[model samples]
Target: MKSDRPSHEDFPHFQTLNTRWMDNDLYGHINNVTYYAYFDTVVNRYLIDAGGLDIHSGPVIAYVVSSGCDYFRSAAYPQVLEIGLRVTKLGNSSVTYSLGVFAQGEEALLACGQFVHVFVDRARETPVPIPATLRAALEPLCAPG
Candidate 1:
């Protein structure tokens, strides 16, 4: 992997994620798949709390439409991670979130990934315009020109 690390300014929002002992694989480092979990947690937590998403009864919901990750360094247990976030794209009924995970206080990122969500009507399972509350909350995270 290249030694280049993205600057903190590259990301908009940030969250601290704890690495659990169980997150490590037999290989002795955090499994590649766990990074995706971290990505999901950071993005969903913001949506659920700030966007007012009722994971249970909300008439509208967002589902992961796609996701991917690129690892630059290994992350092991007992380490605290700072997950940076931002919206790469916001469409009529979908948003693509980009995330960068760094070892706490580190300027370089250990991994970077993206989560694309499609907002839909829970009952009809059809795409719907993004809710105003959700949009307002996500506005700040939207990528700048």
Candidate 2:
């Protein structure tokens, strides 16, 4: 059977993360739940660094309304993970991010996932248009459906 997992070339942005011993489960691999953390980390780190997202005081904020992951292989503790990210859908108030998880120096994905974030007013908690700066940063990552 052919593998459907994406490759590192599929993503425009990348972040390197180290797995902590605590991330391992009794089964001896990184727990399924930890993959979500990697998803969130890469996304937020991009927003903060490139998009000027002020997590603490920005008037606009992004909230993860939906997310999911598919595992093709397991990763153990002490492994270096290279997270690849791309924007698949960019809407006025929401953005869908496609992510791939790979072991360092590898080209194939160990896992793949997508996360949808809805931009909203920090105080009102109501959906708002994606901020200009953030949208600009995300444009380069947008992929045609």
Off by over 4 Å in 1: 1-5
Indicate which candidate wins on lDDT. 2
Count of residue pairs whose backbone atoms collide, per candidate = 0, 0
* RMSD over all Cα atoms, model 1: 2.3
lDDT agreement with native, every candidate: 0.90, 0.94
Stretches of candidate 2 above 4 Å error?
1-3
What TM-scores do the predictions have? 0.94, 0.96
Winning model by TM-score = 2
lDDT tens per residue, model 2, 1-145:
7556667887989999999999999999999999999999999999999999999998999999999999988999999999999999999999999999999999878999999999999999999999999999999998756
Tens-place lDDT digits, model 1, residues 1-145 = 7444455787888999899999999999999999989988998899988889888999999899899998888999999999999998999999999898999998877888988999999999999999999999899998776
